[model samples]
Target: MKIAVLDPDRTQADLITQVLTQAGHVVQTFGSGKDLLGQLRKDACDMLVMDWHVHDVAPVDILRRAKEKLPEGTPMMFITNSSGEDDIVAGKDAGADDYLIKPLRRGELLVRTQAMLRRAYPSQNGAEQLTFGQYTFETRPGRLLMSGVPIEVTHKEFYLALLFFRNIGRPLSRAYIHESVWIRETVVPSRTMDTHVSRVRNKLQLRPENGFRLVPVYSYGYRLEKLGG
Candidate 1:
C-alpha cells in the first residue's frame, strides 16, 4: 500500500514511516499540510495518516481539500495526542475513517491499517462466516464475533487467527506464519509472533465454554485445538 503521513513532528513521522515501511508498505512523509496538499494535487495515495497538529494550515483543511480533489473514497486515519471529545468529533467531521490516540501501539496500528485496507479493497475470500470453536469470524466483513458480540481484532491478528483456524488441530510453525504473513526480508524477532499470538488468545474468548484453545506445541509451533481434540 502507498501511504502519506503528514505531521510536523519529525520524530513521530519517522516512527510511523519506519513501521509502515518495515511492514512492506511504501510510505511518503511530509512535514506539513501544505506539502501534503501539493503532493496530493499531483498524485493521490492509498491511505493517509495525519497528525492533528500541523503549522499554519489545519489537518482538517487538508482532508477536506483532498476529498474534493481526489476520489471521495480515499482512506484516512488521524493520529493525535488529544483524546478530547471535540478533537474526535472534528476528526470525524473532517472525514477521518479512524482515530488513534498516541502513543501508538504497533499491533493496534497494524490491525487498523488492515481494517482500512480491508474496507477500501474488498476481499475475494468466499467465506462470509467461518466457525471455529464457539466463535465466528466474518471474513469478507472483517469482523470477529464471540457469543454474538463483535470482538476487536487487528488486521494481522485477524489474519493470524484465521490461518490458525483454517489449520485447526495441526501444528503450524512460526517460520511458516512469518513467511505467509510478513515480508520475507523482514527479520522480526521470534518474540514478536509470540506476542501477537498471545494477544489473539487473550482477546478471542476461546475457553472451555468457547470450545477452543490455542495451544503451544513446544519446540515446534502452535495449534488451534477444539475441545476433546
Candidate 2:
C-alpha cells in the first residue's frame, strides 16, 4: 500500500514511516498537515494516516480539504490522543474510515488499515474484470467497458459496481453494501445506495425488462442478476 503520514512532529512522522516501510508499504512523511495538504496528490495514495493535531490547521479542516481532493472512498485513518465518543464521531463525520488513539500500535495499524482498504477496494479478492450482462467493468481503471471500449464512470459508480459484481447472485444487505463502499460506519439510509445504483445502471445501459436487472431483494438489499437469471 502507498500511505501518506501527516503529523507535525518529525519524530512521530519518521517513526510511522519506518514502521510502515518495514510492513512493506511505501510511506510519505509530512511534518505538518498544511504541508501535506499543499503537496498532496490524492491519486497517488492508497490510504492516509494523519495525526489529529497539526501545526497550521485543525485536523478536521485538513480532513475536509483532503476529501475534496481525493477520490470518494479513499480510506483515511485519524490518529489522536483523545478516545472520547465525540472525537470518534467527529472523525467519522469528517470522512475518516477509522480512528487510532496515539502512542501507536503497529500490529493494530496493519490490521485495521488493511481491512479498511480491502473493504473500500477489494482488488486482492482475485477479481479482475466484472460483468453484468452485456456490460463489463474494468476494475483497474474503474471504468465500464463494452466490448473493450471504455465508457466513462463516476468513482462512486465504479466502486458500487465492484461491490455488486463481487456479490453477483447473492442479495447483500444495505449495511453490508455501505461498509464495502463507504468508509464511514454511520448508518447511511438505504436510499443513498439505491441512488448510486440507479445512476450506475443508467450509465451501463442496464434495463430490467431487457433481462439485465439490478434486483431489489424485497426486505433484503440488492443483487445484480445476469441477463438470463
Taking all chains together, each candidate's TM-score versus the true structure is: 0.56, 0.51
lDDT of 2 by residue, 1-229 (tens): 7888888777778767865674457988887776788877535577789988775888888888888887788889988885566777888999898988776654456557767877977766343466655667765456677656677878778877766765577797776566556644457667778898888788766676646677788887888876664
Tens digits of per-residue lDDT for model 1, 185-228? 35878888999899989999666667788889898779988887
Off by over 4 Å in 2: 41-43, 125-229
Q: How many backbone clashes does candidate 2 have?
A: 0
Worst 10-residue lDDT window for candidate 1 reads: 177-186
Inter-residue clash pairs, candidate 1: 111-154, 111-155
Residue pairs with colliding backbones in model 2 are none
What is the C-alpha local distance difference test score of each model? 0.79, 0.74
What is the alpha-carbon lDDT of model 1 when measured against the actual structure?
Answer: 0.79
Which TM-score value belongs to model 2? 0.51
